[model samples]
Structures are given as structure tokens and as C-alpha cells.
Target: MKNTTDKQLLRRATAVHRDMLKQAEKFGVSASQYDVTKLLHTSESGKVKVLIDATERLAIAIAKRRRIIICEK
Candidate 1:
């Protein structure tokens, strides 16, 4: 049997991943504002950094939720 704590963490991770996907779609809606030509000239590092930040935020949110679950348990 899977440990309750492990199962809880898995569920939390899945939920956060879904939320991140929704957030990504929301962010994609604003892509029309960028000039493709100018964007092509911009460094990829900037885009990578933004993705990293979003990922980090999602991770932090998941960790916080997990902590809450542990406290409740």
C-alpha cells in the first residue's frame, strides 16, 4: 500500500501541474502583443529565465500546499 503522505504529495504535484498548464495557456494568450521579428532578435535566455521562474513558483506553491497537508494530518 502506498503511504498516505506519498499519495498526498503525488496528488498535490498533479494538481499544481494542471494549474501550471492553465497558467501557461493564459500566458500564451498575450503572445500576440510581442512582435515576432523583434522577438526573434531577443536572447533565448530571457525566455528561459521566465519559464524557470514560473516553474519555481509552481514548485513553491506545491511545497506550501504539501506543508499544509502535513500540518492538517
Candidate 2:
């Protein structure tokens, strides 16, 4: 169960994260560059694996200066 405050915090965190990502992109940094800046240096193994996969794609986009769209079916 989630409360209104919890939902608000989640929205705020997401907005901040998005801004950070945009700044990273503007500065020509890959999303992986901010991975080390995560609140904790650790995450669940499965989540970490997902992050690693997304980071790889972000690295490629940064290297090529092209956008990559990930799709979920």
C-alpha cells in the first residue's frame, strides 16, 4: 500500500533524476557516468543487472551521439 506522501516523494525523485539525466546528456556524459552517484552503491542483483544492460545501451548512444529507444512488449 502507498500513501499520498509516498507517491509525492516518488514523483519528486523521478523529476530530479530526469533533470540529472538531461544534464548528463548536455555535458556529453553517458548515463553510466551517474551510476556511481546513486544514493547507495548497491542494489538488488536483478535490478543491478537491468541497470547494467541499460547502461550499456546508454554508453553506445553517448559514443555515437545518437538516441536509442528501448521498447517493452
Candidate 3:
């Protein structure tokens, strides 16, 4: 199997984030564009995968009117 580059992983994560944002907006919330440097240096999997995952989870919480902290890069 080919190794997935960090950039590629981040791209995929961003797509997930975008979808999360749409859901979040319905709850009157939004997301921030995390700095590239922070993402690049993120401690998880050489990309911001966990961050996006957390964002998705946060969106779910937002939809349910639950309060959650966003982990910005």
C-alpha cells in the first residue's frame, strides 16, 4: 500500500470538516480555519485527522444543543 501524504490526509479531513460546518451552522455555530502551521505540526497522524473527527463529533453535539469545546489547530 502506498503511504498517504499528510497533505492528502488533511484534504480529506477538511472535506469532513466542511460537512460538519454545514450541520453546525444550523445550530447557529461555526468553525474557524485553523492555521496551516498548526495543522502541519499537529501531534496526531501527521495531519489534523483527530481535529476533524472532533469537529464532527462537536457538530453532533451542537445539533443536540449540547455544549462542547472545539479544538482549534
Candidate 4:
């Protein structure tokens, strides 16, 4: 079995972190408000599914950015 360790990424020197946060906030609002509201009128299941998918997509976007930073370093 391989050992699991937490490798930390430093963020102090990253540019556009604030901008990314703003974009993430906007994504959260869109997922929580617009997407859910549009589907909620039809089915609860659809709302939940969309919410989960949006969360995953948001996480992936953030992860991609972090990977880019790590690679840069």
C-alpha cells in the first residue's frame, strides 16, 4: 500500500486568486439560484442533481487552476 500524504500548495504568490474567488462566488450563485430555480418548478430530483453536478464542476475548475499553479512552480 502506498502512503497517503497531504502536499500543501502555497497561494501567496498566485495572481488572480481574488478574481477566481469572485468567479467561484458567481458560479455558486448561478448553481444555487438560477439552475435550481429553473428545475425546482419541475422536479426535486432534477434540482438536486443539477446542484450536485454544479458543485462537481466548480470543484474541477478550482482543481484545474491549482494544478496549473503547481506545475508552474
Compare the candidates by TM-score and give the number of the best one.
3
* lDDT tens digits, residue span 25-49, model 3: 6655644542233454546553565
- Taking the tens digit of each residue's C-alpha lDDT, what string does model 2 give over 5-73? 655654554455556567557747666554533643454233334444445555555545534322221
RMSD of each: 14.4, 12.0, 8.1, 13.6
TM-score leaderboard ranking: 3, 2, 4, 1
Clashes of each: 0, 0, 0, 0
- Highest lDDT among the candidates is held by which one? 3
Higher-TM-score candidate of 2 and 4: 2
Q: lDDT score, residue 59, model 2?
A: 54
Instruction: Give the CA lDDT, 0 to 100, for residue 7 in model 2.
Output: 50
- Against the true structure, what is each candidate's TM-score? 0.40, 0.43, 0.45, 0.41
Off by over 4 Å in 2: 32-73
| Model 4 ranges with Cα > 4 A deviation | 1-45
RMSD of 1: 14.4
- Per-residue accuracy of model 4 over 1-73 as CA lDDT, tens digit each: 1222211111221123334445656544332332233443565233444544554565577666667767989
- Which sections of candidate 1 miss by over 4 Å? 1-45
What tens-digit string does per-residue lDDT give for candidate 1 at 21-72?
5554544422222212234235533443344455566555556665776798
Q: How far is candidate 4 from the true structure (C-alpha RMSD, Å)?
A: 13.6
Ranking by lDDT: 3, 2, 1, 4
